[model samples]
Target: MFKIGYRTVKTAVGAAAALFLAQALDLQFYSSAGILVILCVQNTKRKSLKVSLHRLGACLLSIVFSFVVFETIGYHALAIGLLILLFIPTAVMLRMEEGIVTSSVIVMHIYSLKTVTWPIVWNEVCILIIGIGIALLVNLYMPSVERELKRYQQLVEEYFKLLLHEMAVYLRSRESDWDGKEMIEAHELLHQAKALAFQKLENQFTREDDYYYRYFTMRIRQFEILERVMPLVASLSWTYEQSEMVAKFIESVGAAVRPESTGLISLQYLHELREQFRVMPLPTTREEFETRAMLLQLLSEMEQYLIIKSEFKGKHTYIQSV
Candidate 1:
């Protein structure tokens, strides 16, 4: 249970590599390169690259600031304090706030030397390059999260199937005692699936969109519609012939829930179902009218759900076979 994560291993190896390279090159304060590696490594490629850029920029800025401020005022404790006071605001203004802590280390190294010289400056530059470079190098090999993403996708589909089946059961028999736990479980599963999908999106460098992320987004939208349909189904005390038809349709939709389903066939069937409902005799009793109206609303929500799936599949045709 105390196993190390991939990112943790990356950080450990990167830090050690930075220290080793800096020591081999005889850079001053070689341990600082290890610290830089620790600070730069991140869980995602995009995040790690972004942080490395920010730290690189901030460290360079700190060196320039130190060169100017130390030469002008004198390298004293007060000068170091002044340097940070000026450096922090500049980093924030430039949107490099992530590098503030790492850059501070560079500022101290320059301050400890008590003078600004090209040799000292070159030494700090080497340390910066070695540290950040090693971090970036190690982070280049991000283990594929596709397997985990697929696992979440399977879980979400199963929950959707179960939830739809339960809804159909309730609609068909208004007297059943279903506890409605699947709705909550589906909601939580979609939430986690979306988060994982987004992580997968962030892991890729060139991909602007992820199939799993969009898939989860579409499911979340449909889940919201399902939540609306549930109360309407539960409120029906008297089941009519229309309710039975809708229940069967819901069962079919449940059966269709899978990655390969485009929902186009379901959408066509739903349109036919709507046409059939149009020719049915108008409700006579006040209760019958309300129940029929609610059934109509439920059918409308179901149509929206199918449309969402159809549109999603249309945009990403590759998922049809996946």
Candidate 2:
């Protein structure tokens, strides 16, 4: 069985309503209203508003120009062609090119009526109102996506926890057979969540910054830091004694990562880890030296990771406090 989308159903109902309203009002060339409805319904409310304005402007331009040309040259195919030649350039100049096709319908109505009188103009005006109005009404109530965004937020946090915990496990046991596929999966999830957040931003209709969009963007940045940390983790050998402290800290970071939890405690823990790394005995062998260097780099990257989340949380705190 085939199923129709809600937007499709709304479009059909809106078109029917415009046609019925036009006929009931005894408007001339009533079919134009239905055509206008078909032309005006857009995927987003923002696009619908912009397209409706352009079409309305173009229709008005067409009606006025058709009046001047048909009154002077008489209604004929030649007159319609001449009017279009002039009208296209004018519409382009006015940046109402989107309305060109819809306006042509209005011009044809005038030509068929064979007059440029006020009554004819009024008929086209009514058509524009019914069509654009019904479309605006149809698109007014967008479904809320706050719940979906919350779901995405939780999934992202879960993946962060798992990824960090996996890194901790790897640091502690350098020869784990973990495939690291979760990093790729987490990246894909972030990409999809960001897209959904942007769509939600568009649906908001208000000029306010979206918390979900900002949150997803922060996660994207943190994910980049995590990617950098993985290579450092993979390069080092299993030094259970040396990696013990840092591995525990990484596990703590994974546990602390939450939407409400600021990275303050984790960052403080990171500073202590840095001090501990500094006070350790110097490496005696080349391999030991390289491992120490890799471990230090890992610490730097982890500090940056916690800092990214910390700064994001700080900004939100500042805003809420203000």
Candidate 3:
């Protein structure tokens, strides 16, 4: 893999330049942030431009709403706290993550100010703008947009890996994995990426004649289905078959480790038997041959699915939303 060097320098430069202008204009933190935010947006050429613009608009609206609320109700500690709390649902309802983050930060700056220092407001806004602009510009220059775009594939792979880990967590939990927030976020990224990818494909391949272009569209839909279903099943814990195998595999593994006991049946038979029975049905007894096979068959599917998903390329990945 090619190492990226000095990409930060470009981003830093962009941020610095933008921040200075925002301060000079004496713009409120919201307006300044809006400009910088527009710059920070990950540029997928035209598609990224839209996202950045949309986020800027959303953030601006949120800031206005918060400002009006505070002005009308007075920014008491309780009021400010309530504003922030109320803003949370508003942000989600708006489908505006960046807006929420920016709006909340802006409210903080305003509430923190004993006096609304124009200079401080402008500086803060400029800094945010500059940071984003620098990052976006730097992203465009050194990373090679092609390499960055290949990240769509990484999203696919991540979804699968997270699915496996999430499943493992769920298997250990009765209801749901309490610590699954990060995994859920990772899965969300997959959907966001898919949405962005769809927009990019539409813009770049408007003609619909390109093969890879068409496949990319298909990939997004497939990813949507998997993301929705994987989380639902994450907490199912061990399937019926895997639970059955847990007991049998324990004894076999035990006998293998100690050689004092009969390792009855050939190793090849054990392999064939496990695969054949992994999915048939849960066995009543781990010692019973029929039951052992069913457990092995299911575990084998789980193991195989995990292995294939590590790379994020498989029939499962391409599956349409169920």
Candidate 4:
């Protein structure tokens, strides 16, 4: 089965409309308007506006330069050749280089007519208006992705919970046969969530940043810490009392993981866990000492994890985890 993309469909419709309106108004070189539509349509509304403005500037430059040169030098091969040579640098200087290709069509249209007149210039201006105007209109009707973003947020939290649970299980039972697929899945989910958040951010024309954008960024940073924990868990060879204690703390963190979770409570609980680790009997054997050291490292990683969430929520004044 073949599927057409939404932007593809919009571009097709916009181009067809530009062509139809240009012909209906009896504009000369009406096909150029359609070509402009195809060239100006962009992936995002902001991009479309930018390309349209650049093309408009380039088209105007081409007309002015072509009129002056072709009129004085006579409409001949040399004049057309000379126009190309001079106009390209002029367009680049004006930062309308992206529109150079599209505007060249208008130059050819002027040369083919063998005379630069008011009506000819007006015709090209009309074409530019019709094409760019239609493209802008098409861009105005962006579909909402709020629901999809919410769904992604929910999925990310679910994967995070699963990841914490896996970590807890590994810490509790040193020899468990758990493959680290959940970590990979959580990483993949965060990647997708970040992409979606970026798209959502681009869809809006706002000066202020969206909360979801910040939320996803914080999650992405925490996800890196999560990835680091996996190797540390895999390297452990001994099961100690400290390991289970840390495992229970990780389970508490897993229980509290959510998009709305500030994790401050877990941070406090981590402090308590550290105190418990402190006043307990010291390790006698080298193996026990190594286990305690590993547990301490894991605790540091977990503190970093909670701190990231705290900072994000702190900035926005929103408490997500308790």
Task: Please name the candidate that would achieve the greatest TM-score relative to the true structure.
Answer: 1
Q: Candidate 2 lDDT, tens digit per residue, 8-100? A: 877898999999999999988888788887888876687788889999999999988998999999999999999999999999999999999
Q: Mind giving the per-residue lDDT tens digits that candidate 3 earns over 1-322?
A: 9665443455456555665666566655534543453445453434444455545555556556556666677767876777867777776777766556656666666766634445654555455555455445544543333444457555545554454444444433435535656555655665665565454454442433232333344444544544454444442433454543343443343233211212233243346555655456555654545434434443444333323223333233334422
True-structure lDDT of candidate 1? 0.89
* Candidate 4 residue-wise lDDT, 138-227, digit = tens: 877777778987888888888888888888888777666767777778788778878877776776787255677788889889889988
> Estimated TM-score per prediction?
0.95, 0.85, 0.39, 0.89
Off by over 4 Å in 3: 5-10, 24-39, 113-210, 215-322
In model 2, where is the ten-residue run with the lowest total lDDT?
Answer: 313-322
**What lDDT does the true structure give each of the candidates?**
0.89, 0.86, 0.49, 0.86
- Candidate 1 or 3, higher lDDT? 1
**TM-score head-to-head 3 vs 4, winner:** 4
Query: What's the candidate order when arranged by decreasing TM-score?
Result: 1, 4, 2, 3
Q: In model 1, what lDDT does residue 109 have?
A: 87
TM-score of 2: 0.85
Ten-residue segment with the worst summed lDDT in candidate 3?
Answer: 254-263
Residue-pair clashes per candidate, as listed?
0, 0, 10, 6
